[model samples]
Target: MSYKEFLVQLSEASGVSGYEGEVSDVIKKAFKEIGHEVTSDNLGNLICFKKGKNPKGRKIMLAAHMDEVGLMVKDIDANGFIKFTTIGGVDQRTLLCQEVIVHGKEKVYGIIGVKPPHLTTPEERSKPLEIDNLLIDTGYDFEEINKLVEIGDVVTIKRQVYNLQNNHIAGKALDDRVGVAILYYSLQELNKLQHDVDVYFVATVQEEVGTRGATTSAFKIQPDIGIAIDVGFGKTPELNQFDTIEMGKGPAFTVGPNIHPGVFNHLKTTAKDHYIPYQVEVAANHSGTDAWPMQVSCSGVATGVISIPLRYMHTSVETVNLSDVEKSGKVLAHFIASLNDENMEELLCY
Candidate 1:
């Protein structure tokens, strides 16, 4: 499937943190259609295996999370309003006036309601916003809403993927779903290449809550090399050059203690040899991605990270450049194509 179509199907589906069943089905179907041997782990991670010509050769793992940040219903007021709490890191300021799909006994549309400005006191206007003060108005009374909605139902942002000027697109859940799209495209590219290493492409779950899916998958795979595909902060007016990468420039890779030097250098060399545009990201500590867990998995796996530049992360209007995503996939495919026993020996030789 085309990247645009794949993104729409993924973004429209709601798979918040722990509740990733709906989106995992989409990923499993795509992998199966691509002729991969796909299976889900106990933690709900989607793992696809593609055997290489040399089954005994090095094992390479590629990970991209499938879960996104959202809210869960917490309480219901007598007036039929709903109170919700975040499932991940959520900025309360962005809650007001946002449309949400409440997943309950049935799908219900609701909006984050705010008090009218006409009635706001001067003190209220000066105070900071809080999620506790917000409520979701679904246009149903207590008795009516009680039958359809219940506590613990997931509430996801209701938005459609749309194109933006300058070859960009905006929508919800682009954070890691964009990574998932890259993995799909990379698999398509890898199918045409001859590589010596066995490849396992994993769509991890609950990454937003904790890197739980990656942890379990990495332990099970025990790969010789692991690469985490995720989204990094994109350039915005408020962000500094050191903190964000420009959208459409190509993929940015992490370089730090968390990243293996040999793997990092291999990726840089592959990009240069293939004439693929890429930027280097410096992380002093952990990269805050699946790379961290993959690095420490088992006896220790050589790990690297490739990230697409994304704007308005964790918001409903997260934006990314499609071309950049494609570039990342192609670069990954080339990197995989170059892996072999000889390179593996040198890469692990300290």
Candidate 2:
């Protein structure tokens, strides 16, 4: 499938933290066509394994989270306004007056309700809007809304993918859904490779709340090398150069506490050897991807992170460049093909 098709399918799916069944099913179908041996962990992480040409080869794990940030219903007021709490980090300023889809009885549509400035005092208008004060309006009475909606139902922003000028794409859930697409496409390309390593393409869950899925999946796989594919911040007009990378340039290789030094160097060398365009990202502490937990799992696996630069992260209208997405996949495919027993030893040193 084309990247555009994958983006639409991934963005439209509802897979909040701990609720990844639907997304896992979609990904399993895609991998099955490529002849991968697919299975799921007890925690619902989808693991697709491909046998290598060399029998006693190193085990490599490639991880991409399947979950996205969303809200869960907390209460329903008498006027049918729904109160909610965020499942992940969400900016309250962006929640006001936006359309949302409440995954209740049958996917009810609603809008985030906010107090108009006309009704607010001058001091209140200048202060930040508290999350507790916001509610969702579904145009129903309390009794009627209660019949269709209930507490703990997932709620996601209602948005569709669209193409922008300068080769940028915008939509919701690109934070990690784009990572899933990259991993799937890379595995498809890697199926043609003659390698000496056992590869596992893992679709993890609950990364937004915490790297819960990766933690459990890595413990089960016990791979020698683990690589996490996720979205990173792209340079925008409002963001400083130190905080983000340029969009459409290429994928970013993260240098951080969570990533293994040798794995990081190998990724850079592999990208250069394959003539793939890539950038470097510096993260002094935790990388904040699945790599964080995967690194320390089961006697400490070699971990690294490859990120696709995305703009306006965690918002309904996240943006990414298609060229960067494809380049990331190529880099991963090449990296997997270049690994072997000797290189695996080198990776273990750092």
Candidate 3:
């Protein structure tokens, strides 16, 4: 399948953080299509492995979280209006006037509602409304709504995945699902290349919450090298000019303490040697991606991070360039193909 098709299937699915079953199915199906078997762990991580020429040589893992930031039903008011709590790091500003799908007994469409501005004082209009004041209007009152919806049910913004003027994709859940798409494309590309180290691809869960899924998966896999694929801040006028990466230029390769010097060097060299367009990013302390936990897994691991530049993260309209996703996967496949015992040892001795 094409990258857009793969990403759309994942982006449209209701796979909120800590509730990634739907996303799991999509990944499993894609892996099956590519002739790889997928397995899930107790905490809901989906794993796929492609052994290298020497299966026992070195092991490397690539991870991309499958969870998306969403909301959970917190309370059902007397009139059946729904009150909800933010699931991951949902911005309060984006919650108003949103179209959401309540995942209760079935998918129920609803819109976020609040006090009418005409009836409100000028002070209220001047301030951002708190989440506590937002209510979901599901067109059902009391008894009828209670039957179809309940407390604790998940809610996701209803959004349609679409393309932009320059092959850019805009939608919800692209935060890491696009990373997963990169994994899919990488595996497809690997089918054409020969490599010497075993590769493990993990679709981790709960990254939006605390990088929890990668924490456990890394501990279990204990690979010699690990790479986390995630999204970086896309350049916008609102952001500091030097802080965000340009959207269409290329994927950003992270560098700093959280990243092993060896792994970073390998990624950098691969991009340069193969002429894959890429940018450099710095993470002073922790990168806030799955790479953070993967670095400290078990007896410690050599880890690196590669990010696809994205805009409006944690909101309904996250955006990414399709070329960036394709190139990220392409560069990663080449990086993996370049691995061998001699080079790996040389990289790590630093």
Kindly indicate the candidate among 1 and 2 with the higher lDDT.
Answer: 1
Show the lowest summed lDDT stretch of 10 residues, model 3: 51-60
TM-score of every candidate relative to the true structure: 0.98, 0.96, 0.98
Using TM-score as the yardstick, the better of models 1 and 2 is 1
Q: Residue by residue across 1-350, what tens digits does model 3's lDDT show?
A: 88779999999988999888777898999999879999888899999999899756689999999999999999999998999998889999988899999999989999998788899999999999999889999999899999999899999999999888898889999999999999999999999999999999999999999999999999989999999999999999989967899988899999989899988888888889988889999899989999999989988999999999999998889999999988899899999999998888888776
Q: Who wins the lDDT comparison?
A: 3
Error of 3 at 136 (Å): 0.6
In model 1, which regions exceed 4 Å deviation?
Answer: none
lDDT assessment of candidate 1: 0.91
Error of 3 at 212 (Å): 0.9
Off by over 4 Å in 3: none
Quick one: ranking by lDDT, best first? 3, 1, 2
Tens-place lDDT per residue, model 2, 33-117, is 7677689988999999887766676799999998988899999988889999999888777898899989888889999977888
Distance (Å) between predicted and true CA of 82, model 1?
0.5
